[model samples]
Target: MDVTFGFLLLFVATFLVAGLVKGVTGMGLPTVAVGMLGSAVSPVTAAAMLVIPSLVTNVWQLLNGPSLGALLRRLWPMMLAILLGTVASTALLVEGDSRWSGMALGGALVAYAAYALLSPSTSVPGRWERPLAPLVGLVTGVLTGATGVFTLPAVPWLQSLRLPRDVLVQALGLAFTVSTVALALGLGRLGEFRLGQLGWSTAGIVPALVGMALGQAVRSRISQQRFRQFFLAFLILLGLELAIRALL
Candidate 1:
């Protein structure tokens, strides 16, 4: 099979698994999928595959999550920061050296994973949290635009909140939705959203939905603590994987 076709298959499989993780735990779509796919293809392709599916999947989340009024009140500071940071980061995207961008992002994920496991609170604490929250959005935006690895800082911050399963899931879903739309626009401006690319990217929606459907059916069977533990472990391993791939 051609390398391109192989990568397309990889995208479907990656997001299918990502969708399962998202449906079961309410997050991890970009984290798991991008971590794996970024290793196999140009980060651009990995990100492109996610565009359509993420947009579709997050619509459900936006509707199902906490009320818009409540989420806006609670998360506005973080959201505004996200907008500014995404714009800045996307503007600086260097199509020239994405490998280095990948390396930087891979390292950031590793650092975040280490902190989460070692911190007593499993949280970043108060003052540090608010400032860093926006920075997280900034960093993730840069990586998302440059290397298609868009989970780093945001995931850790969100996870640190230690919200109830549903709240956390909804928050992640909403956040992902916002970020994905910004990215889609950025990619379009860069001429990265051609018809053929959009078509294949859109194709992943089927598997994404299917995986989420299957995950929802089984979500109740899984233990929350067990899922959290696995989630942390997955981040650690994924961080390591990206680092290793970049180094090699």
Candidate 2:
């Protein structure tokens, strides 16, 4: 594909916005980018585009935060679950119809948002927390690989746990890393990964990193509640887009 100046310009602007979200929140990179670009490109391409940028920004998060050992120990089960889900879903990619897929994705997001708003329980049960985290990882991995959507079914569960803010951010960064890696591998195997595609995708990280630098400065000023509200609102918009696309 010719690298149109139009696509490049859109890519730069979208990456900057996505980067700001990731820079501050540590996990919304793909979400924000995909949501914006999904309208302009096929979702598959959008998913592939994220691979390079996500890898770049996530490396920054891991370096700045440096909790790999702890995160690995804590999230291994979830990682494995995600891997399994990705493997199982690989075959479905070719047959996957985006409109129907969008419906499924939209339903999951809507349900998640509702749960986040209305769940009676504030935290996972002690017994469930250990097992459930990975289960969330599994769902997130499947959705991410199949649709380039990272509506991790488990994020709300994690949020409800209310770990220290930094730990939560570290955990999210790790989750993004795992999902992004799996999606890249699966897409590569399926031949959706390409050098030219990646070249453009790589350009997105510049804005993402800029967002991160600015995010650090703002993180301390924003209350967690405000961040949560903003994230939920974003999810709702994404979900609505998917749902409406499905209907159309």
Per-candidate Cα lDDT values, in order, are 0.70, 0.73
Candidate 1 residue-wise lDDT, 1-248, digit = tens: 14586776777788789888778766667657767676675556667767888888887766776555666666666766665555555644436565565576677777777776676367656778666766677666665656555566667778887876567667777677778887777777777667876887788889888888777666657677766766676677667766776677
Per model, how many backbone clashes are there?
0, 3
> Across residues 156-245, which tens digit of lDDT does each residue of candidate 2 receive?
656666665667777777667767787788888888888978887887778878877888777768887776666566566667777877
**Model 1: residue 93 alpha-carbon error in angstroms:** 4.5
Model 2 — TM-score against the truth?
A: 0.87
Which is the leading candidate under lDDT? 2
Deviation of model 1 at 10, angstroms: 4.0
Off by over 4 Å in 2: 118-121
User: How close to the true structure is residue 196 of candidate 2, measured as C-alpha lDDT?
Assistant: 77
